[model samples]
Target chain A: MESKEINLPLTDKAIDGLQIGDRVEYSGILYTARDAAHKRLITLADAGNELPVALQGQVIYYVGPTPPRPGRVIGSAGPTTAMRLDPYTPRMLELGVKGIIGKGGRGPVVREAIQKHHAIYCIAVGGTGALLNRHIKNVEVVAFEDLGTEAIRRLEVDHFPAIVVNDAYGGDLLEAGKAEYRTKAPPSP
Target chain B: MREIEAGVITEAVAKLAVEATHFLPEDVEGAIRGARETEQSPLGVQIIDEILENAEIAREQMLPLCQDTGTAVVHLELGQDVHITGGFIMDAVNAGIEKGYGDGYLRKSIVAHPFGERKNTGTNTPGVIHTEIVPGDKIHIGFMPKGGGCENMSRYQNFLPGAGREAVIKFVCETVDQSGGNPCPPLVIGVGVGGTAEKAMTMAKHSLFRKIGQRSEDPEVSILEKTLLDAVNALGVGPQAVGGSTTALDVFVETYPTHITALPVAVNIQCHSARTKHTVL
Candidate 1:
């Protein structure tokens, strides 16, 4: 399958053009956040307070990387389960977050928000952290340092691999892909 | 009594912590490679390839096989005749965890409390340890670093005696279905039957320590394991739930005697990482 190379801070037009099952190699900047950071972001938004980092046109990767070993830019960094962040995703989408990179499927509301906002939900292989970390060139903690692994990070990546699971056109690769391979079980005796 | 030093246990556990995180066990690696060969979906094949590549990278570079290096779960089979010397066994294990996680650069994932505080433990210490007293003089330790994604998908139930084999199979399959791609399929399904609620759960976790493809010594349970494995794979959840024929690599069932009125079951799902290591002292 042909994989498309995409620059981060995706434009609405760029996101709209993508579809479920399309392989993508993402480059440029991607932000990192997991459940804790998501809660903080939501709380700040509800309080009508400014976020520590701007969300406009950025991609948030659901990940909490291991601490880097000596001389390494980062340690094994892979996607966490995306559904855990489902409750906080729609709001982030409303804030103009253009893309999400994580493993697993988003809930219904998050999918609908993706369609409405012309954003995309992408998945990196869940257990492939060591491989994924190689794509990251640099990392900086931008907020919530006290959260340790859950802290928000700004990452510069090169050709980071992902697959679009939910797209602006309401395409869901998880649903489509599963349907293709689903086999009927033998009748229960 | 055979005496074992605290330092010996700590050193062994420390080594296991790093080894379990960095290396994919041979059985697990073989199963994944088999899944890649049999997987029919293009997307499934692609994902398996990446997983295999990830294992290679992690092994070569001494990096963790997954970012969620997991809660350090240590299972100890202590012989009744052995005496642990120097310090408390639990303290030795925790000290080893601190050193291993810190030196290996594995993620410290444990929070201080489930509901309150939620502070990082920093050392990933106070590991969830399961100890059993058995015959003989050797101390056998099994180290399993279980990630949160798959662990969250686990389920337990207390069914009435009327709920038969079919119901148990149905519950196990449905749990895997609801889990879909979240637990990082292809997976290993561990089923614990006939025990008390907590016993069933513990057995479910312990069943994961068995080598992939190894079946229960009980012929009846062995058949049930096969049945559940087939049913789970048929769910069409596939690899990463993206679709394929290999959603589950194996199903391990461990059963114990229970009261005539009760039938308890617990299902523990393990991701493809399947990281485990063992030592006998």
Candidate 2:
């Protein structure tokens, strides 16, 4: 339930301290990467080659936004499901990525990566692409433009709203919250 | 037999496809707003508000309500006494899909193959069409744009003859609960029971086109829908399955007679953005 507006140069402590369900107003540079871009990023990091952009303390938003209408900065820019990028997230975190934003819960591998790397996973509301895009102040393609919406775009954001779903401390809001509310079938009467 | 021109049906199908994809039906919008009011979680409330805002943007910008745009699913109720002239009805439907997807700038999501050499169709055509002939002069077309996220989560199960209603209910709830926050929640659960596997699944998908909160025509099925809806919401999957009071917006069940040995059921979980439209001509 804690709320805070954040700016860049985020520390591991700053991200790891968050718990599930905390509201964040993120204002700073966040990069967009989806399935294809995440693969490319990992390859570059593995090859010991320079990344298209620095990952240290950077936030990556998993999205494949629709094309923007003429005169609009971006189109419906919501978080895609997180599990699609679960395979690549731990690698990114190890390479110094600070926060991952998307919808849906991540797998054990990703949760472990967050704890080990002190990174965070934020849940941006799904299907709110247009509303979410309004928070982007500026956007530029950093790499993989041929991936269409899946390209890596460097986005400048202001108070982009999301909930801390998973944090470095190992709090998983999706799991904990669901467990609290899951009504088990009543024992045989 | 009364003859109708292919041009007429083609135009209608195209318009229906574009309209269904471009606009979120009014009832669907209303249901989301209603869910927003009743949802208890603070995060859920914020998410609902953003969804509402997204709807406005989609309308103002004339963009597809969701980027998925979806696979074109056309359901046709053809009159027994009528004959189509100039072209095949299926041809008209495919042409309509192409025109709609091309002209609307929607993402053509259909693939030529599943599993290997998966390639985009370029134009969203060769729709999943179902036709039923009935005693009438007019044609009734239902256009449902089925998105991938929810479609991927759809399930079909064949229950033992003795599994009964409780098993069916458990299956639906378990499936949706497992899909928490993934199918993009505040979902409408469409349950199809008592048919063969494929038939059951199709019925479940078509059941999504039912008006939100409307009861099934069969009283037993209506009761089942209510029971399932209550049980699913009780799961607290909530908006975006992030936890709240409103996991499923409604549950609509469609059933048909089945073989003596099987009690087949299919659950087609759809997100809040259930895009569908219908026209009679």
Candidate 3:
């Protein structure tokens, strides 16, 4: 169970080194986006217009965090379901996006893109937002403020924990991990 | 008739929203701790540890347990003999939600329209409020902040009367299997059986408010709960679907008398967060 300490704007070497089920402590910048912001990003990309933030060699976290209370940098910030972003993921990867952070299994197209683009997909513990928020050091809205929480935010995170669920080599931990632990179905009642 | 002020209802619901978001109910917390100890996979154990740690941090700092904060669902048990004063009950509940979501810094997740513009309401108003008239004079309010991930995984089916207990067992297990890690296992599954389609769905959602590990009073229903729980845990979906022996914390079933020809069933899946709070006024 070797754990890797990686930074954002991930290097090609770093993405290549990741494997399904590998533990990772990610630090550095992470841009947050969920359904609404993702739609806007895809629209912008389709129109051949510039994106609000550069995508090259960067990681995007599929999250829409709670509003920060007074004196706090951010609120409970955790990953949303990832499958909803599948349509936009391949395009982002084509733009040199290095990694994605979200929960649950990704679609086939996104998985194919991960292998093709040599990108990685990681998952923070879903529903563990309070703990995850402690790892974030700074946050600022970068685009789509009209979407409110769904607005894209540039974040600086330190020791933000996650496990690789999809690797650049066409491995998927969600399938492999469950297969390894699956037991015989109980007899019919 | 006893009179209760609208502001009182608003204050109560407001507090409930914040507390339910920040605190994992005692039963749910206990189940997670128990799951951590018994979980066979190292990865599962690690995930459970993080979940418990998150709960601790949320409780200590008064921060929300998850980023979703969820769509506020308020269930009200209004006594027949009691009178609501000052304003419309629905408005007061909505006002409470606005205050709670605003004051607690919870996310305003409600959208104005399902289709078309898809604009956010900005205020987490018009909470999904369910009301029932009861015998007692005191009103009971149960507040549950339900996240979208798990709700998305819920399902309903109208099984033929011949479908039997085996069919149910299979359906529940398969649902969890298909959901994999998306519903955020280890989960609390609520099953509703023996009612009209809508009634069954409502029962399934309401059953989730029951304490974890509490069984239905009916002998046959309790057995079904146990059997479903065991079968689901056997799926090895584990914590976050990474793999483990503790996929489900518990299975709760609520049943009603049904027409002889119909056997409607519904499954409402709840994530490990399993947040709920109640107050009687």
**Candidate that would win on lDDT:** 1
Q: After superposition, how far is residue A114 of candidate 3 from its true place, in Å?
A: 0.8
Give the range of the ten consecutive residues with the poorest summed lDDT in model 2 chain B: B116-125
TM-score of the second chain, cand. 3: 0.99
* lDDT of residue B154 for candidate 1: 94
Relative to the true structure, candidate 3 reaches a TM of 0.98
Each prediction's TM-score versus the true structure:
0.98, 0.92, 0.98
Q: Clashing pairs in model 2? A: A77-A129
TM-scores (chain A) of the candidates: 0.96, 0.94, 0.95
DockQ-derived CAPRI band for the predicted complex in model 3: medium
User: Candidate 3's residue-wise lDDT over B108-174, tens digit each?
Assistant: 9988898979788888877999999999789999999999999999889888898888888888888
**Chain B superposition TM-score per model:** 0.99, 0.97, 0.99
Local distance difference test scores for all models: 0.91, 0.83, 0.91
Give the DockQ (C-alpha) for candidate 1: 0.65
List candidate 1 stretches off by more than 4 Å: A185-189
**Per-residue CA lDDT of candidate 2, range B144-248, in tens?**
888777887888889998998898888898889878787889898888998799899989988998999889888988888899888888887778766787888
lDDT of 1 by residue, B1-281 (tens): 99999999999999999999999999999999998888888888999999999999999998899999898999999999999999999999888888889888999999888899888889997799999999999999999999999999999988889988887898898898788788999998889998699999999999999999999999999999999888888878888888778899999999999999899999998999888999999
DockQ of every predicted complex: 0.65, 0.41, 0.65
Question: Please, what are the lDDT tens digits per residue for candidate 2 over residues A1-189?
Answer: 557878875776677567778888898899999877888889988998998889899999987766666787776677877887888888898888989898888899899888888888888887766567678888899898876777899999999998888887898888777766666552231
Candidate 1 chain A: 10-residue stretch with minimal lDDT: A180-189
**Candidate 3, superposed: residue stretches over 4 Å from native:** A185-189
